[model samples]
Target: GGGKPLAPKNANNAAKNSLRVADIGAGTGNLSIMLLERGCEVVAVEPNDAMREIGISRTKDKNIKWVRATGLESGLEDSGFDWVTFGSSFNVMDRSQALKESHRLLKPQGYFSCMWNHRDLNDPIQEVAEEVILELVPNYTRGVRREDQRPVIEQHKDLFDTIIYIEEDFYFHQNIETYIAAWKSVKNPYWDLETSEGQELFDKIAYQMRHKLPSEFDIKYTTRCWSAKARN
Candidate 1:
């Protein structure tokens, strides 16, 4: 018999008044796909061409509508959505303006959900990975992008209420080769492959990965999920 994956999947029942969600700054449509699977009609607003293309190719569901728009200007209808969410990209946006837009697009009593899957840098393997990055990029700092959303969250506190924060640990296992490849695909890679300095740095990192890291290891992460209702 078939079964659910680690993430819960909801059956499609949109014909029967399913929830609607607008996933702003929906890079690669991961959040949109997940919400669509949960029986929500999702509008994925993205402004970047490369990311939008990948997201379009990855998600072909009828429930998902991809729009080339930023979080600050989603162009969604007023009070039309039951929820608005942002994944890892939230901290990168103008949070105050983003919240204002979120409030405008969501129905009263709807929720704004934000989450980040942060790597467990404290892990020895990850520690080494950071060291490798610093050795190469010299300025790679963990959580540099995430910083803190609290100030912005507070700045717009009047627009939302019933705030809640929850976190959980998750483990993803992969081979060293897969890990290396994944890192290479990361945006603004710590080491530039085209430059001689970057090549030298990558070579060093590669040597470490091949000789030191185990064939298979876990990449642990802490996922933080925060949700607040849209105030009337």
Candidate 2:
């Protein structure tokens, strides 16, 4: 038994009380919950069924609406939101199209933001993990998520202005089991996990994590963010 899923509050009321935000590709609603806790009325959009299901479950008690949609084509109303955000999901989208959609969703001068939490591969433990993956999956790539986002965001100067970028490093401590599970959730498009080589790579990583690492360890990460306001 849960309360009714959060619906969009009245426009004037939302504008008076808080910001209305569209969280595109809101995997598991992590960022949505954060926004909700900070008094924003959030609409969380996710295209994948499994991920959306988990997201709905996670935010059932929170006041956040979950929508089935993609970042490039979120089926939200025009000029209805004070902010549009993509949390670590922007790299998977066509940046140009996504920016257009975000601009369409934002109110006048509303903000648009995309951010990623990047693991510090240079960390001692992470370095070993990376070496293991590279040894097995020789073609492993970090993809666009690691690349600088300024050039692409700047490309859409017509849609947005006043680009603001920030980066900060932090550390998280977790058990070996939890860390391994986190790795499993990262589905790399190029990595053919059905192959025997893929299985071996995972098995080897798990073995190394269980044997080589301590029960609980600190992992370093940098949170990178880019934001801009609607041009018109």
Candidate 3:
């Protein structure tokens, strides 16, 4: 699936009220960069060395502290953050433990938000791409089932009284070259598919898709975001 840019919203509402913010599993600091641009004191927790390096290099001018830590053990002080965000990284951790840790680190009324840029399976091309990836990487875990969001929210209802959950579709325009480059950026299943056979399969799929394109293609994306606050 293509890595679509996050939509702008009232995120600053939470940021403005908070004195410090931390982005968990901040791969290459995409969301962290935005927070910095918004003038928030931001810290990024990323365990992967290479990914952290990329983020550090990208945000050289911005004031972003990078820490090598997982979701459950962020190595941050207790009640240290007023806002904590997980952009496209919530599914990678033990959700229950991560939620608990988030609650622990957040001060009273602090917000915990999670966002994901998912492919709209309803789109034909996206559906085909999903099928291709599934067949190619059968062992890969299907991260973040779409239907489970409501249940997750229910499980944490007591922790957060005021909840805002939303899913929206966004469209991205890209040419074949840009599309391929975007695809290569995806880790895990795509990165694992570095073998000759995998390359052949990806090339074949890209070629087939290119023939159907009219100089450019519209990639549909579904972005799901959930925000809640730690009750006092």
RMSD of each: 5.6, 6.1, 6.4
Q: Give the winner by TM-score.
A: 2
* lDDT (tens digit, per residue) of candidate 3 on 1-232: 2211223245556344434788999988888998877667788999888789989999997767899998789989888887889988887777878888898888788888888877777887666666655665566555564444556756877676567788898899978777665555455454435478767767765665566545677989888888887876
| Location of the lowest summed lDDT over 10 successive residues in candidate 1 | 1-10
- Rank candidates, TM-score, best first: 2, 1, 3
lDDT of 3 at 183: 59
- TM-score against native, each model: 0.80, 0.86, 0.76
Using lDDT as the yardstick, the better of models 1 and 2 is 2
Task: Please provide, for model 1 over 1-232, each residue's C-alpha lDDT reduced to its tens digit, 9 standing for 90 to 100.
Answer: 2211222334433545667888888888777888876777788998887789989999875678899988897778999988889887676667788889999998888888888877787898888887767766677655434565556677787898777788899998989998886665344545666679876777787887777678899889888877778888
Error of 3 at 123 (Å): 2.3
How far is 196's C-alpha from truth in model 3 (Å)? 11
* True-structure lDDT of candidate 2: 0.83
Query: Tens-digit lDDT track for model 2 on 1-232?
Result: 2212233356455435777889998988878888886668889999878788988988886768888878887879999988899998888878888899999999888889899889987799888777767776788898998999889889999998889899999999989898887786564664445678776778777887787778889989999999888877
The Cα local distance difference test for each model comes to 0.77, 0.83, 0.75
Per-residue lDDT for 189 in model 2?
69
lDDT score at residue 43, model 3, on the 0-100 scale: 89
- Better candidate number, 1 or 3, judged by lDDT: 1
